[model samples]
Target: MGFFDNLLLNLDASVTGLFGQWNIWTSLLATALVGFLTYQVATRQDPDTHPFLLARQAQGTAVRQPGESPVYRSQAAPHGMLLNAGLNVKDPGASKWSRGRDGDLRDVWRQAVAGVQEPGPTKGAKGRILTVLGAEKIVEHNLDDITRQINLIGQHIADQGGNRVAIYLPNSVELLATLFACAFYNLTAVILPFDQPDDAVISMLRRSATDTVVTAPGSFPFDAVVKNYPSLRQLIWVVDEGSKHMDWNEVPQGTGGSVNVSTWQDIVNDAPLDAGKTLPPLEGQKEPRDVTVFWQSKPGQQEEMVRFTAGNFVSAIAAQIFAIPTSQRMGPSDLFLPADSLANSHTLVLTLAALFSNASVAFNSVASQADDLATATGGIAPTILVATPAALLKLHTESKPALSSFIGSKLHWLQTRSLTQKGMMPAAGGLLSSYYDRTVRPALGTTTTTTTPNKKKLRLIVTAERVGADTPKLSSAVLSDLRALTGARIMYALTAAKVAGAVTQTNFYDYRVFDDKCSHFGPPLTSTEVLFRDTEQYKTSDNISQGEIIVRGPCVAGMEAALGVAGKMREDNTLAYV
Candidate 1:
């Protein structure tokens, strides 16, 4: 009818005659082919190491010397397009089922940082990879700093003759240093939930027989928790953001037992740099190091101590990294924010997951407050946001008041549909998105534009352990709500005690598949197999599914205990909760 319409018709006719019809089915087939090729490229792996490739290089080149290693431009190895990490050689000690890095967790870090050094205080140093949010200064801890602190901490705890140490601090840079230190040595690290009251902390400490407590100043019931646990003989305190300090001697000593208190600052100041020098003499003892124990409690039951071996830990980290989309892997370039308590399974696992991929992790302490987790995350947008459903629910509740009126939004949606059909604008930059984001979004307090080149897109990774039958954090509602508000992809995860990591996670691209209130957790992670067993105990866990989810895999603990979770596998290879 118009000049442009006539021109478009002519072009379409020419294209059809020259090539082929661009129908819906043809477009879908092209999309599938492109996706398959992209997947192959993204998941590519180099089979042969540079040394091996050079060894097989042509003999006439500069590497002509016999048995000489250095060479260039060699033929590629077979199946060199797989996504892999860590040492490629076969480990004699690694089990066929394991297929994991079989040594200390620190080894994983070594692999992650190899040849990826950044220039800093030390020449080409891998400096301070952690960021503690809400701190007065930019807090960061590098591998060397972490190692030095570990040496000092290992000796201090060893002096007290205690191997099991409980960390009862909020998400901080110090927490990361301490956990890795305990794992490097053979000490068992117990992550105590910082939000618990004194009674719960003391009860869990006594149950775990934790002999050492590491926490920051003025943490919840610090004096009360350490005093009640008689097995705990030492209290290692760390410094807060400000110069504010506390004296352990000033507080009343607990009559329950005689406990010696020390500060992390004092220990680092007093201990020598070579604290781990003596470690070489005791290296070949064949003792299983890095035993990390996570405590999960039921309302009327004793706290469950889930023990994770180094193999289990490595497997869990690997599975978490692979569970992410190949394009959105939490790699070295990403900044991950853990808004929930690091003690929670999801936060803790994803924190280390980011680390294993050489990505820096950022911690938000405001989220640990009584309320305002989502509010605290107002301006700060990290590439990956790992949060609990409770935190996301708080955000959702706070965002509801900021949404546009019902009728106005309906009109805007209709307008967007028509405009998109006319090819005038992108769906993302439609009238509704621009209007609500500009007018109502000031409530969120984000000043920068979402399209800024430097600003990373947000990917919300939610764990539902905090959302129960009585909780307000409905999975389906929270997922859809937060996605609509922030335009971010939300991936949900389910934690099982026996499973070292999340048993299942929603696919990276799958969003809001269920209109019903109940939401699905997607599918089991790689190297994991899951089946449903009929059980009434976990029936209350979900409404649409009734069974105890049984998972046995490389990262799964050997146990048959009912995890009190109900789920079913879908034909699309995802798990949906009723």
Candidate 2:
């Protein structure tokens, strides 16, 4: 008893001595530390997705090739189940319980016209189509008028015996309507890059075996196209409203009646007033024709024609539709704009998906240019913007140097913490944002002028890196910086030449910066599976599976394509090029 009492007494004495030495400053400091810790614990947030889910995002096959790694697929499709195949397009009057057929491009227009169909009390609604003329002019087209144009164009092409038609115009109402016209009329649509040189355009025509050509009046060398390609049968000139006063029907002197020529405006005007009000009747159950795209491995390389069947495109569209969580899926309330050229398959697929979801779409003629992103999206604010890595890199590089001021740097650091540590996007603008805008943005010079309008309305920025294209690399740190600056989430995709949409895309909610050099492309999409072909130097048995990437799925042009680039599968099952 005496020993216990003495020990207690000594402990109490030590505590009293420690407390007795504490002054007002020390006591205040201790209280502040305790309160800060308590506040932190109370305000902490859960990550966007569970960590375990990220760890095992994809599944591996039980068996593997002799020297290659086991095939990896999205968790959405396991070993025994089938991968995503098509859009599951149900025909009109088909049983609600029956399985849908793999629909063609005609069905895409039908769905857009049908509008949003949902259960319960929500009524169906259609989305508008907007065309940006320039910084000051935006035109909204009526669906009925667009339908009329489609019918006139389709009937004209079919009557002229045009089989394979090349659409060589910039992104405009005419381009979209002509594409749909070909779909409805069962003619193959060949998409050629609008910016190619005259010789390049002629070469593409010969290579694609295109019988019909649709383009602007003065865009290409008309005489050269007719002289070099004897198979050309029809030419439709899409004259702008400003230049329609000039005569565009003049053909070369020696051509005679062999080549039939027409203007888009004349075709629409010549049709009866009530001709194209309603859609043409479905032509029974026949499948639509193929859609061909030109693929260039790099600049100055010969372009190759890649033909994609309706099944390939529909499957890719469906895959992209379901890639996002159901709660976050696009709907009628959103406006989607593709700042990149729709000639790129990835951009085209996403645009179609947006249309299918009943979202408004905007097109700009300045698309596909690296430095014209701001000019393309100047007036309207889009909820979703799809662009190229070059465009985003330009934005990042230009805006970075302006944030060197002490206040701007501190604000950037706080925003970075919100993204990196908290897994949440910072609020778009606040008092601090106003202060930064006035002080820091002025230093940005012309960059401030080129900044996207109403940036606060932007919810997502989708950009991709073509595998073999000569473009700037987007590092994870740069992506993090972009996220901080834009106040919007970014989805970085890795696309290949043979894949319809994308080989793999980063998770929407994944904001981690894994490496400073290259960001990891997330798991294979649900529409496809990926495997690495083992090489002598980089084998599957290494710490990380490394080799060439092999992709296979319905979205692939040939059902399987080998991406001729070195890649590695990380421990977390993400993919990154070596």
Candidate 3:
């Protein structure tokens, strides 16, 4: 008792002596420190997603193949539950209690044209489609105008007995309208890459057995196309306003009258003004025709024609729509732009999702090219952007020199800290933002300009890695820097040729930097599940399973596909390429 009391007395004496030595300034300093620490603790926020959820992103089946790991699925659809199949299309006058039909591509257009129908009395307005050239807005078309074009072009093709139509134009309104027209008119649409050579285009058309082709005037050798493609019976030239004066309907002399040629503008002009105000009624059509994609695994390789059914496309579109969190899902107010080529399955599916959600869309011909992103997106602001890894890498490399400066370095460090350490995105547009823009952005030539009110609206960037394509690898550090620089959350996806959308995509809230090589692709999409096939070198093990990626689900083109790339599941259950 005596010893304990003495120790307590000594401690009290020391505390009193320490307090006695403090002047008013020292007492104020101590109080301020305590108050600041309390405020920090009180105001700290939890991460957007719980760590527990990240730790177990996918669920594994109990039974497994002898040499393979248990099949893994997104927590959204686990084990025995069916993966997302198709859009639950509810038609007008249908019983609300009945399960909706698995809709096709035609339903996608119908939903877009019908606009948003809220529960309230007021009806939502339809979204517009804009065509942009370099930073300039060339033209804006309303939903009615697009529908009119679809009707005219689709009727013209059907009248010509066109069965398979190849769309060979750039990212233009014509390409989009034609795709939808094919859906409504029951024609198979073959989407060909715009950057292909004339010979490659001819090869793809020959392989696809394309009966009709829609291409830009003067872009390809008309003689070569008509001569090479014997099955091609019709050629529809999409002429720009600048070249509308020129006659593009002239067939090559040797091809004779075997092939019918027409101009898109003439077709529209000859139609009644009131045409295409309503979608063509589906009398006996139960589903839309298949849409084929020309998949080029690598440069100089023969393209493989991958056919996707209406169910396949709709399933992927629906899955992508629901992938984002509810709070961050796209809506009628959002503006979406595909900076990458829509020929990419990932980008195509996302664009369709945007249209289904009634969001405005813009197209640029320079998509997938080495163009300045700032200049490409100058005229309008996009809330969501889908780009390729190369485009983003260009932006990252260009900003490096600017970020190397003292002010840029400090701001970048602070913002990165906020993103990685604090699980928060630093707020944009303040004195610090203005300072960085003035000092840093100017140094980045032609890629970014001074911060604009519209520029700050970019919230999400969706990019992906083709499993076997020879593209630059996007490291996690680069992605983190991109997030800090652009102030947008990035979702990196792993896409395979046979998959409709993607095998797996990172969560929008996943901002951790795992390594300098490749970022982790979160979990399998709701429409698909992932598994690993054992190889001689890598096998399924207790600690970690690494092998070839095998995917199976409704989103897959053939219901199952084996990705040739090697991958492993991380401790956090995220998918990463080996």
Candidate 4:
């Protein structure tokens, strides 16, 4: 007591001496000065934190600041702008997606890749670019390497008279290179889903009129499948080593030896670096790289080939970029993991979105089950995840409860809800992350039922493509449980089987307003235009609530994604599922 009292007496004396001479007004003024200086430093260092992003900072809409992230928050009364609150469709001539080079996906992709060339952080190959998974070692591809491969592969297609090339392999860096090569050479890429049965694949091959099939070294019974379809003139095996691949001599004989087997290495390695020189310039074509992605209307039914043009791809990338909050925007430093098969529209587009923004992409198995989801999340620990509602639901149901129902309710209202109403402090980003600084790891034998900790926490990129919005269980509400488990901010979308890509997506920052109970697929993407007509999609008797939804934009259907899909629209400009 004697020692503690002496210490306290000394501390009080020091505090009194320091502030006693300063009046209350002076102390308050000094505090304000310090706070102002702190804010100034933070904004200057991180431009995204500045209040006006869609306004003044949008000066270079496509450009990202070096070192600092583009995602930001509001200092006072903070909220994101209604990117499409009102359909600014007064002038049909004013469509930005249709303005340049027809706003083709090819051009947009080119621009997005170019944007990354700036002196800053990046991921991928050759020069710390994209990273490919499934290899015994790490593989990266730079823009130059990708371009070279594209030109050579494009040249190969031109020489083979192969107008349509089908890729039937798991996610890898080579698949991306091939798709870009198709875009580069003005050839149509036919992508076959990797998960389909051999019979389904063979049927789709014949139906697609595919001349060549690209696949991994040991993927399926390539010989048996291709034998059924004589139109499949070639089977190109993907091998990291040219010498190790089964040579043409070892390949199975197709009908009349019409099928020529080659390795991806042989095609690219043998071509000259100046292969693109002889190819026709993209400007000369009336239409550019057309892609045919097969969608099975049902599991056992015949596949429908939905064609997408470069322009549609471009619009998709641009609109997707606009949809991501600057705070959550994909950057060069962030690693992207496409857990779902790249065959899915959402997965492919998001991959391109990351590359277009100079971010890195990693591969993981198609997350169709809870185990797969857990493995993918834990293996990659991705910051951005592109998955379907089914996978998300699986993870939610499989997860060990962090809080009991009653305690969860208490935290939801008392903690998560309150902080969300007041914008998330940039400093609080870690609070939702596994690296949360405030909480200490509990020792063994401790039973902290209220705290559910995820060592690999990640945000979500989900789609409502096949979901029935009116169905309570399968609707966006399914993701509510998942969000609470991982503190992941989900950006859900209204994607359709027939649609070229995303029709509507939630604003990343706007998740808090509409919590976990109901489905909230945000407004239409910037490049898409939507309108509704009376249809069965309108479950509600209210005249304004339901109707068949129609969209016209670069991300629509048709070769250039200039076509539209049928759906229902709400009065608030959101798309209702058909």
| Model 4 segments more than 4 A misplaced | 1-137, 240-249, 253-256, 270-286, 326-328, 365-371, 405-415, 419-460, 467-481, 512-518, 536-543, 558-573, 576-578
Candidate 4 residue-wise lDDT, 223-300, digit = tens: 667567767776677774544644643654443376777777777777676655333355465466677787654456
Give the Cα error of residue 544 in candidate 1, in Å: 12
lDDT of each: 0.57, 0.80, 0.82, 0.55
Residue 497 alpha-carbon offset, candidate 1, angstroms? 2.6
Question: Where in model 3 is the C-alpha error above 4 Å?
Answer: 1-17, 23-32, 120-123, 255-257, 429-456
Q: How far in Å is the alpha carbon of 181 misplaced in model 4?
A: 1.4
- The alpha-carbon deviation from the true structure for residue 323 of candidate 1, after best TM-score superposition, in angstroms, is 0.8
Candidate 3, residue 269: Cα displacement in angstroms equals 1.0
Error of 1 at 194 (Å): 1.0
Residue 302, model 4: lDDT of 69
What TM-score against the true fold does each predicted structure earn?
0.70, 0.92, 0.93, 0.69
Give the per-residue lDDT of model 3 (tens digit) for 315-403.
89989998998888777767788888788878899999999887778787876554456655666678888878888888888898989
What does the lDDT come to for candidate 2?
0.80
Best by lDDT: 3
> Which segments of model 2 are wrong by more than 4 Å?
1-31, 93-95, 120-122, 252-257, 283-285, 427-456
